[model samples]
Target: MKGRATGGLIVALLTLMLAACTVVDLDADGKPIMPKDPNAKPGYSNQTPQQIAESGWASRVQQPAEQQALSWADMETKSHTVKAGASESVFVRAGGVVTAFDNSNARERHLTMTINGKPVQVQIGPVLRSNAIRDAAGFRFDEFTNQVQYAQLTKALNRHAVKQLPAVDASWVGKPVQALLAVTMAPGKVDDVVAIQLQQGSP
Candidate 1:
């Protein structure tokens, strides 16, 4: 009887251990990993990243950018704040002089564009780090299930945005250029607009 009781306790403990493991998903560094299956997740499509990107992302980003665009002079003066979930950003449609280029690294590519005597660093990517244009549109976070869906949308937007850039190089320095930009709020970050969409030539 005592032997049967001991075996039962061990079985119960094992069952609980298995249940705990099934409920928790940990990454390599022991942090909780967010689930990435879009189909299993409500409100997101089962489509692959490329397929998902093929429709509507451009219009969604473009509408907000065109409507909210501010001139460099006006942007410097206003207290603009665009909400995206808990975060905020802004948009600019202005002309600036190309001060310099940082395209040597390739992955961290960008250029310095001076607006009203202040240097604003604009991303001209063969690789883009942030999805500022998309994020500036204020899409809700809970609308997507996981980082996979979120990042795929970003990748698509970046691809389309990059295609709009002027054919630039070291030659572009000291020339006037105009673009629509998405950037984090603040004049300090007016110098750091990631992921730009452009209007090339004499501005």
Candidate 2:
């Protein structure tokens, strides 16, 4: 009986190997003939990044705080909050805050921002792991037909943000200052806020 069972196992293994080695038939164009599904959606938008940026970005950034953004304090207590994996635009005016520019990572130069009243760390970046600026710019998902269009928009915004900052030097380090931050937020009690437009001055 044991010998019969071993033979059956060997036969099963051979069957699986044969199935795994099945070759796909090719078409006249030398491409594999894939089975067609009627429900498949495989189209992307032909809209250019320059066209997209020109159409709506100016109006989005120019919108007033009352119309376009919510206060940082209001988003807490569950009243106004961006859901997890969602993004929101916020305009914040903070004074006497503790912050420092850490250029340790040349690739991701960012300021470690610690607002006095709020318990959140604000990070400025062209390449940080947050997409608040991209998502919070009043853009609808349907506007972008594919992932590529969405990604390029973020790159355009980052270029604009880098121009908004003062020269990367020791002029504003460890000083008593005020900051007006137009930033984006994601869900959670307090974490990182990606600043879209940041302005600073001595208090």
Candidate 3:
């Protein structure tokens, strides 16, 4: 009888151990469901943008390729004839990498890319309509931008055929990139970049 009792106690201990090792899942109605695997990879949905930027996988992505020099003189020549009334779209094909992106303003975000080692701002937003007769001018990415303007710029950037690397903080610095810029020409003012298509390979 003593031996029989010891065996029953051992069985009870083993049952308790097994229970401790098991995981329990419940549905919204309190019904038991299968537990998920504890070893599965975690999802990024819960992570913030900052966290994603700092991830190990972020460093492994391919960088932009170097592109041929763009012709600013030619762009300036074309700018001379643009009539300022309604907004006119001028295609500017330039090749370069972003050197700086300024997000200091609460409303607008501005970036500068180097073409042939010359820094030029990537313009974002509406081009003003003027009636004065003046020489056509090359585009400029306006320095003063607000947060609302920055949002509009990002939306246009997203439409690019090639996915641009995130501009989080200064991650875009020194990264070679190219774009088909849609420049807006107005009288007496520098051309404004209203749209952009970021390219992957050389343009």
TM-score of each: 0.66, 0.59, 0.39
TM-score of 1: 0.66
Name the candidate, 1 or 3, with the larger TM-score value.
Answer: 1
The sequence of per-residue lDDT tens digits that candidate 2 reaches over residues 1-203 is 99999999999999999989858799899999876678865322655665565554566543543264554455453323557776565555555444567667765666655554543454555455555555556566666777778888766665555555555434555554454455654565544465555555554
Which numbered prediction scores highest in TM-score against the true structure? 1
Worst 10 residues of 2 by lDDT: 71-80
Give the alpha carbon lDDT tens digit for every residue of 100-132 in model 3.
977666234556888766787764222212211
Better of 2 and 3 by lDDT: 2
Which residue ranges in model 2 land beyond 4 Å of their true spot? 1-47, 64-67, 78-93, 96-98, 118-120, 126-128, 176-187
Superposed model 3: Cα runs more than 4 Å off:
1-73, 83-87, 124-169, 186-189, 200-203
List the candidate 1 regions with Cα displacement exceeding 4 Å: 1-43, 77-87, 186-191
- Select the stronger candidate by lDDT from 1 and 3: 1
